[model samples]
Target: MVVFGKELYKIKSDRYKKARGGWSRIIKLHCVECGEYLFDYQKDGAGILKRLYFDRIFKELPKKPLKCKCGQLLGIPIIYKKEERPAIRLFSGVVKK
Candidate 1:
């Protein structure tokens, strides 16, 4: 991916256990520079081409910078380390009921 000269993005979306019609997922991708909302695509995860589609988009990284409607740089983070990716921490210690 580095060959593309673009920042890497770890997927921030959650995994769905069951999809009614098919394996549907709401993909949430943010700009690496400004952390702005890049685009949210609703897709069928079961399609064979779908995997290739996503890989082509993320791996290549669309010039790596999304622009606002005004044409200004959104400044999303270009590079993200493993630690920089966000995670959901359920509990830190014992839970009280």
Candidate 2:
């Protein structure tokens, strides 16, 4: 759930190892509104909505309204609004349990 963009934000880089290559960058974009996870791994870039961007196709997403196929309306609910942190962080040692 680590949302990355302008800051070179680090999630579990150890977890996202195969997330390499130009335009082949794999990412899991979480929807704050629908509570779903989307991917940027497919070769077909248009498979997911660009408004969701995944930090690749679009620079920002707060203004974008998402229409999930499941009929959930969501988007980058935290972007352009506040500095929100991921609900969970792995290996970075935020876990206390």
Each model's number of backbone clashes? 9, 0
Model 1 deviation from native, Cα RMSD in Å: 14.6
Error of 1 at 9 (Å): 24
Estimated TM-score for each candidate? 0.26, 0.24
Per-residue C-alpha lDDT of model 1 across residues 1-97, encoded as one tens digit per residue: 1221244433323333133243444455454434555544344445421121223233334534435444545433333243343222212221111
Candidate 1 local lDDT, residue 84: 44
In candidate 1, list every pair of residues with a backbone clash. Answer: 32-76, 32-77, 33-75, 33-76, 33-77, 34-75, 34-76, 34-77, 35-76
User: Model 2, residue 35: what's the lDDT?
Assistant: 51
lDDT value for model 1: 0.35
Model 2 regions more than 4 Å off:
1-25, 30-37, 41-55, 58-64, 76-97
The number of the candidate with the highest lDDT is 1
Q: What is the lDDT of residue 45 in candidate 1?
A: 49
Cα error of candidate 1 at position 72, Å: 9.4
Q: lDDT of candidate 2?
A: 0.33
